[model samples]
Target: MEIRPMRSWIHHRRGEVLRQGGVGRSAMPGVYEDMLTRHGFEGRDAYLYRRHESTAWKRAEGAGIHLDLDGRLLEPTDLTDAGGNPLRLFYNPDGAVSVSRRSANMTYSARNADGDELYFVHKGTGTFYTEFGPIPYEPGDYVLLPKGVTYRIRPTGPDNYFMIIETTEELGFADIGPHGRRAPFDPGLLYVPSPELDDLGDGRNQDGEWPVRVKYQGGFTTAYYDFDPIDAIGWSGDLFPFKLNIRDFRPITSDRIHIMPSGHAVFATSTVVVGNYLPRPLESAPDAEPFPPIHRNMDYDEFLFTHAGTALGVPMPPASFALTPRGLHHGLPAKVEEELRKGIKPGTVADFEFIFVDWAHSLVATPEALAQKRAGDQLREGVAAQ
Candidate 1:
């Protein structure tokens, strides 16, 4: 009888990285082809390609749509000044993506019975008045209002910016699995709004009535109340509005490999998954780089919002968004990869803070977003003028 410890050998052949390290060359033919075909890169000339330094996809024909905007410039004041309502960037039957700006307090509360509201405060200080209480929010807070929750925003100043993810399914923390009870942070640390009864002109107008608007079945219906919509004296529930600061998120990292996108997931619904990418230690492996691998996500449509990050010597300004549909090859630009190959010291902190969402089903881009896309010569001219 023979009992032996097996050693796994990682191997490379013909410019492809393979996992059967200890296998002899005579045993590689079938295994190599199977691996390539399974990954959808099969070809007689199939080889690894890097997208780490190339931004040419922004102009590529037939590429999945991507959007990058000066999110910081997309303030509510600017939208109102430009005579536009909150702008929708992408949408589908399941959900929608948009940005909203508010300069003053809202007079009426809003309740969306169709879906949950996930608000990322890109800029502004404000109080989110809800049935549970007055929840104070500021930049970087992720404020979640579950379906049917009445709420309104009141900014302390004249400017507020928010990115809204309206998911048809309710949003909640992703299952952390073996990571821990709170892989990111404990639920007790979540900022549950302290309930406060509002004093709205003695609880009512001369007519002794207040108003709350419910958005459902496609349109709004106004509901009259004897007191303000936020006049809940007290409440308790596992399902209530709360805020989680992105700064408080502790991203899972790896010492020797690039952490998979799933490792960064913070919020999830049956159809949508949102990841918070904060500054963290980069992959320390000798061959692995501090960027995403070139591949496709066949199961989900993916997007990234660059709240902050520096990549390949370029500072990815906050508020930029990018979308890549399933089966598309996307990753770091070529220039960024080139810089990484030259070597960045191990343990250097990655200067990136962003959010990524993967929609399990396809998402449709709005015509307005398509119309706004500039490429090729037009894109060049615009950059030159800038």
Candidate 2:
């Protein structure tokens, strides 16, 4: 019988900061005990949770669950040289996700119309020949190729391994702010391939046999060329391939507080964000917590690929990959905390080099990545007891 503007129904008792008109916005009648803020609340995006506190260690139920990257993750990539094809790990229908391992040199050039590609060189050296030019890539180099760019990998040695991430969207560097831009080397230092247009002339493919496979519409169509595919007398455009070394990425740290994971982000798009945790000094404050805060991030599924160094004393070797789904609580173990308490030299580099990918949606874990997943019962039981 009453016509009034509908107000949020938040349950709150006196003395609660979340009470009606108290602190945060109130749409319901109860207090939201858990609040996650981005940009230290300056971003103005606050996620409120009811009866779900990420710090509730008692609810962090896990039993030593682990995804072993070296054994299980790499097992699915056992691509035989039957036809000299690369092994694919996973592919999504939306073309938003694709991971593959390439060892043998590629024979044909490829052009993807769906998205860009990022290749992490794990072993060997090679020259990535693209329409723009030739990029000499070595181990630890992250080479990025934009969509519609015809390119092929030419390995110089017999041993070569590559981790490739193909995304449906264009990839660009994160805002990173003035601080991150200043800490790392100048952005201009990134290596861009100079135009090396090599025309094979009319004799290279008189039979019109060389095919440049174009990927689109869920499949591929071959485009035959009378000459070599890398025939670009000269090219000019903002879109081109580039390479950056992991050693060139300098991490940003806080002297008095622990920096958030996003602080290390190097590149990102609407659906995915990529970060690099390079060797850096740990939190220098005597009482500061060196590890990330315990919380359940419901926004993105996190994937950590260990490229070098042990991650937070976890003994993560190179090529190790791990995925922590959304709503899961992951943090440093007690033993690690104890070790941190023992006192680390102020400038001691924690040697935690890894690539962190935060996907907006749940990442589809391949069966091979799930093969050797360790039980999380211990973590569950420990959290319950707490």
lDDT of 2 by residue, 227-248 (tens): 6778776777788889998888
- lDDT score for residue 48 of model 1: 42
Candidate 1 Cα outliers beyond 4 Å, as residue runs: 1-16, 19-63, 70-85, 200-209, 371-386
Give the runs in model 2 whose Cα sits over 4 Å from its true position. Answer: 1-68, 71-100, 197-208, 312-314, 371-386
Per-residue lDDT value at 51 in model 1: 22
TM-scores of the models, in the given order? 0.78, 0.76
Error of 2 at 201 (Å): 12
Best by lDDT: 1
lDDT of 1 by residue, 197-304 (tens): 667442233466666778676567878886676767888777889999988888787766666576777888866878777888766566454554345556667777
Q: What C-alpha lDDT do the candidate models reach, one value each?
A: 0.63, 0.60
